[model samples]
Target: MELDKMDENEWRYHGEGNKSLVVSHVQLSIVLRLLKYPAEDSENPPQTVEQAFRQVQNIVDFSSNVMSCLLGEKFVHSGEVVKLPLEFVRQLSIKVQHQRPAWRCDKVMDIYSGCALCLPNLTSPTLHQPTHTPTLCIEIKPKCGFLPYSKHVSQDIKTKVCRFCMHQHYKVAMGTWKRRSRYCPLDLFSGNRQRMHFAIRQLIDEPQNNLKIFKGGRCIFSSMDGIEDSMDLNSLLHHLRPYFQYGNNRINSHMTSKALLTDFIQVVVNALLSAGGGDGGVGTDRRGEGRSFCEASLFNKERSRHGSQGSPSDSVLYRVRQTQMLDTLDIEGLYPLYRRVEQHLQDFPKERTRLQMDGPYNEAFLEKLHKCPSEDDGSLEYAVSKVHQYRVAMTAKDSQIMVALVPSCEEEEDDEGLPGQRQHRDFLSSRPPAFSYSVSILDLDPKPFDNIPRQLRLDQNIVSCYLRSSCALP
Candidate 1:
């Protein structure tokens, strides 16, 4: 008998006895990486399989402990399964599926087994009569792990809320709003005046969205329209101030409020332009009618008196930049970023009344102020190019990281140079020396090997016996 072939009990006992057989440290590290757990030096490391299993048990125990703490109830362990009292399993299952498919599978299997094995024992009925006992069977299959226990709860609570808040806070601190929003904290609310003031200073110090709008295809306005655009333009300017205030309130201050505001405004303007027309014109301009009206309206009797004698009669030339294609692309990119920013702003906390006052606001802060949409560049090609470049860089980085993480393979092969040399020598030596062609070998035709059908012969024997039986009966 093969020594490797062991009984179930023997295998189980052997596996239990060997502490190293339960889990490998490398496997544990892989699991941690898959789970995205932060690496800490103090964390226990697994060297053997048993140690690994113990570590897994510890994880399960911790999970159970957390559940107990949150639910205020001890988990009842029946056999192999530890029934979770809390309703977070469904949500946990979704997180696991997204982040740790393998760990989730193993964990679920362990829990199910624990539940089954931990059941309380009870006496059976008579031998002839069957005892009606509740049997809880947990099936462990590769595909079965995807089944979510609490689907309704998982779908109800939005998981992106916290992430949105964090991102919004970062943007607000960085003052990216100079290009993004319509109102600042000073204009919107009165509380935390100092905070907002300080934030504005920080935003002015680090203005990122200045060139971003030009890249985003904002249209530059003539000096005349620039004056008329001040009303709506100031609205966006005001909206960005609060984000600057909030961002400056943070400790690290990685982002400035103006940058966040700029990013946001770019999104809004792009959206407005997208919805109104491909050129970001609000529907006021229908075909050429609106343009004609604006031109005619601007060149009224009084304005015409100021013009030179007989300047093209009454026809007014409306100079609208041809940006239909560029506007479409800008809007497409702007909408997603806008939605993300909006979601983040919506989730931001409303606790702080006003921003704190920090450094003095100077020319730098004033310089950070972005020109309104009217002053934007005509094309968004630069922005599009930047986006594409960022995506390419990220893809390259991911590929490099994956390559580095994966193990390399090595294999041996025969020396082709030596084989080629041997072949060359044999050909050179045998060229004219082996010219003896044998007639006997040329006339030889090998016999074909016969393959008999064993099944056919057996059938023939059965047929003969059947015929003999049939004749005797007749």
Candidate 2:
């Protein structure tokens, strides 16, 4: 029985999103992601069993095949899907109830789900690190990095303000969020060193849902909303001292915790900057002199268009910006195209099969997706192809970045036998601590195609509220 079924007690709640619940295994370096549905409609849920199965399959395939192509394979993890015993899943859900956020309790676990995705515990230190070494993991959800360039966007504000910033007003008005977050996606995605550091600090100040910090696979700091006993900045800094301290420079009572906190933020900034390119060094540090989003947007545009030699095209920000360009039409224009494609599918039954989720996850289908319309040919196929690419690009825009840092052991660094082990240093402070780190993008789940209209409505609402309130930044 033990071999056939998982032990519920071995797993604890990790975190949850709108669609899923994750549980980390206590004894193993792996996690199980199970699907969830609204509890109110459990008796008659909107999604059928077949649809749910297809949804799960689409996530695995899209992450492994589609997103992995767009956002490099080294950064994305395509976990295997496995069947879990029904009783085990039910027991597991019950065990994790108390840990879930109060606001997220509207949705309950899908106990009927036989399958769950098994992914490597990203918060855990990798094999190269010693067992006792502490791992500090920071997860950042940098939403919608670029300002809309679509001519069809009727609102001029959309061109000036980013989606994340505008949505903050809407979120606040709706009482979903108590206040607007100061962290701007444009800053982090600016590819500017100082700006990125500023963005990280803003997230630390008011994390909301944008940032989460974990120590040794246990969450140390995140938003305090409905989450019990979460650590504040001071407590977080105290806990982080050991990682920032160097040889013989122990983080004793004499050492200022403020310095260690600043150094730690620099380490994260360096990891994010460097992870996009070749081994060791951070990417190009384009300085915006701490300009406003509108001002920085212009600078960023200039930098992206006429980037110097060795622009680090492989950098993660570059990849994201390129993908964001797919939505040049923006939702205002894309919605009409989506509707036309939907109408066309209704007219032609055979064409509907092409958009169905029943197809096997493979390269052939990906090739078909890749072969998009080169231009606006004003055909049904062109519209269909455009909408498809837009949805795929949305996944990239909403993805989360994980920066995992582990304190380097002297013996491990001295092992000259190992090739390609480029150690990164904290360049922000004098006598910086040396640490090994890795950056990865997670939550590459494919967005539903049907959300196009909903997004259009939300975009309109956000702009209207932000404008009506006269909250446009100078």
Candidate 3:
């Protein structure tokens, strides 16, 4: 889609006549800057795709707390709670063939998400009603891993191992083909001829061996800079252009992709709602509840050295750490963040009232509250409590990670002509590749300095239950 000229910070888009949407785009790397310690452009972000998803999930969830705070007493009058759908429309330089060969757009919309809305919890006054319309919309851009740098490995002897593929490269003395593994006989030797020794060197040379791997580390992505942003867009376009077409015979809409993306947006919104009531990023425990700093890695590395040795009363470092050990909800550190988002909304051209929240269960409870003009039956208090429960509850039931299995291999002759090649072969080529995807709703970002496992457990239970459930997910 083409954008109209406005200013450096945002792109003003048009839908119907006199109606427009102003979108401010940011990079994923920029979001990393929000972390305790952001990585430099020269260095890679320490986390993998899955880990990054969890980090984003945490941030989205924590942002929900701000939404809850914004809702405040408004929940009773306005009868709503605001929710953020992490469906951030990111601008990237993905290749798209135009009427001419190379017309470049300063930005193109991707599958990334980060949109927030304060509406009714699927209930209360009822969202999109006669009185409530969250007209203001602001986009927060985080510099996530959009385009990654591809490592150029030399084909020399030392860099024999390729990150893209794992083709076996060993032969026995009798000309028999076999991979050199720990079980191989040739690995028993030492020095230059040792098979196991070479493998060990190769292992050490691989990038990101130190980082934690998920699911038995089968989906290792830290070393491999993943397929590029353009590749993802291109794949999406390729999937869309078969039947559906726009003007001039060019396919414009892909129904399957559009539906899946919509579902992905729900995943993010639910994640944020989940974060609000659970712990508010600082649970009952005082540890990790104090100050929230932008620097986590570099700053901590230096301060931690002398922080403990100094006296708590006299030493500045000790005082800082000691203060940090207390409750974070007691601090005003999150005030600026909340204010900034509101300021952006206020500056927008639309008229927006106080923020609110929304979701399935929240909506039902709000409906009950709206009907009960009094609390004589005690249902009003119970309904309000249910709203809170819905806020902190997990969202995995709505957003689930899916596994799509596609055929990646076909039967082929072993041209080398091994003895009974035609009838029954090694079957390596026929092996199917499992579907590995980055769930729109990743893991939770735990409260800083909090050693408690509660948040982690909540996040894990959501995913585990989804996997175990018979319900279908998009």
Best-matching candidate per TM-score: 2
**Model 2 Cα shift for residue 274 (angstroms):** 1.1
TM-scores of the models, in the order given: 0.14, 0.87, 0.18
lDDT of each: 0.21, 0.72, 0.23
Report the error of model 2 at residue 378, Å.
1.2
TM-score of 1: 0.14
Per-residue lDDT tens digits for candidate 2, residues 1-474, read: 242667988889898888889999887778888888898876665576667677678789988988887777767787877778888987988899988888889998887756678887877636246546768899998888777766788988877777887787788989987877878788787666666767788898889889999888888888854555464887888778767666455634445776776788888876776653344343443332232254323234454343322214556666666665667688998998988887886798687667643344467556656777777788876786677678777988888888777766555554332343222222222255756676677787878767889988888898899787655555
Candidate 2, residue 227: lDDT: 52
Model 2 residue 36 distance off true place after TM-score fit, in angstroms: 0.9
Best candidate, lDDT: 2
**Number of clashes in every candidate structure?**
76, 0, 34
Q: After superposition, how far is residue 221 of candidate 2 from its true place, in Å?
A: 1.0
Residue 371 lDDT (model 1):
18
Residues forming the 10-long window of minimal summed lDDT in candidate 1? 400-409
Clashes of 3: 34
